[model samples]
Target chain A: MELDFSIEGGDFTQAGQASSRVKKVLKQLGVDAKCIKSIVIALYEAEVNVVAHAYKGQIHIQIDKDKIQTLITDEGPGIPDIAMAMTEGFSTASKKVREMGFGAGMGLPNIKKNTDELKIDSVVGQSTTVSMVNYF
Target chain B: MKVSEIIDQLGLKVIAGEKGLDREISGAYVSDLLSDVMGNAREGQIWITLQVHQNVMAIASLKDLAAVILVKDLEANANTIQHSNEEQIPILSSSLSTFDIAGKLHALLADK
Candidate 1:
């Protein structure tokens, strides 16, 4: 099934809702446990990124028999340094995001870990597109 | 050990989904970072965290954690509880801090 979700950056409280819904759909579809874990982790980390860094974004999820692809796009402040952003402890969130127990700089790294193929394209002050693919 | 055993031992209060305590957890992972938990947590484990975010539910569900125990008496919003309910994920609250709860759970499960 091909699933698409629009994520609003209005409230931090609602940040992970889309990922949760995606998880439920994947579960009801009887996706493999390992594949489900991989997709959830990757998708959630990406979702966290959009909430933490971008002003707004959307998550596009496509699932088939052997693989899942997720494209998360954001129209917020892009990364100044993709290399630095990928570092485990580097974060750009304000005091508020930090207070929420996120913005600790683990989001991107976690997404990268869970997927088999990952790509990030960003330009400072433009936008970012993060693509992740997990093969079963 | 079963999650109920840990709860009883620590005197935890179930904020939601009390009936699922019969779940078993062989180990524990404590972290406020959902990413770290996702990267490190193993199956059949209990996650003790101070972070009361919806992502905690996502990470726990992905890992198939036996239960999630929020230490320091922190509270999550309705959305968190709602998502957890749909996923059938049990989230408990404890008056103890993360350190105390982790110690108690680790010691309780270790000897067995």
Candidate 2:
């Protein structure tokens, strides 16, 4: 099954809606709690990344008997260096955003750590797409 | 220790999830990095951080944490509280800095 939720940039209200829904689905599917936790963390991190960095976007979540995948594509000022952005403690968010306890440069890295697979594609003026999957 | 005593000893407020305050916390982590928190936080630990976001509650839930405390007078808004409630995690706000909360919590639990 699949679930999709639009995460509005600068809108903290809807920040974890997608992850919450996914968590519920995994529980109902009888997925292991440990695996469910991993998916929740990775999806939550990626969702926060889109909300904190992008110009507003949607998270596409797909779940099956084997694994869970979260594809986050955003239309915003794309990241120039995926390598740099993946580094811990590297961030480009504004001071106000930083005050909210995000943009510490851990978003991408966290997604990478929790998921079994991670892929990224981006451009400076166009958009960014982040794909991650966690296997059961 | 009950949540009431922790609140009394530390001068903290239960922003939401009142049902969970009485729950005990085993170990608490002090980090603003959400990534570190995802793997490091264990069950029943009070996550003491200066960060405030809806995702924080999500991370705490994944860790099976007992509660989340925003140190140094940071505010955890309505949505954050509501999310914590749904996750069955107590969302707490403390005027004490992260350092102080860590120290106090450590001292209080060290003997036990």
Model 1, range B67-94, lDDT digits (tens) per residue?
A: 8998888897786787677767689998
B1-83: candidate 2 lDDT, tens digit per residue: 65556777777888877877777768678888776787567777888888777778877876778788888788886777888
Q: What is the C-alpha lDDT profile of model 1 across A1-136, one tens digit per residue?
A: 7888777664565556666777788888888777777777778778777877788898888888877888889998898899999998998888877876778888888887788999999987979999888887
Model 1: residue A90 alpha-carbon error in angstroms: 1.0
**Candidate with maximal TM-score:** 1
At residue B59, candidate 2 shows an lDDT of: 75
TM per model? 0.88, 0.86
- Assess candidate 1 and give its TM-score to the true structure: 0.88
Q: What share of the true interface contacts does candidate 2 keep?
A: 0.56
Q: Which has the greatest DockQ?
A: 2
Residues A1-136 of candidate 2 have per-residue lDDT tens digits of 8888887777766666787788888989999888888788788777777777788887888887898888888888899998998898899988877776677777777777778999999988888998888889
The lDDT of each candidate is 0.80, 0.79
lDDT score, candidate 2: 0.79
Segments in model 2 whose C-alpha atoms lie over 4 Å from true places? B1-5, B8-11, B51-58, B72-88, B93-95
Backbone clash pairs for candidate 1 read none
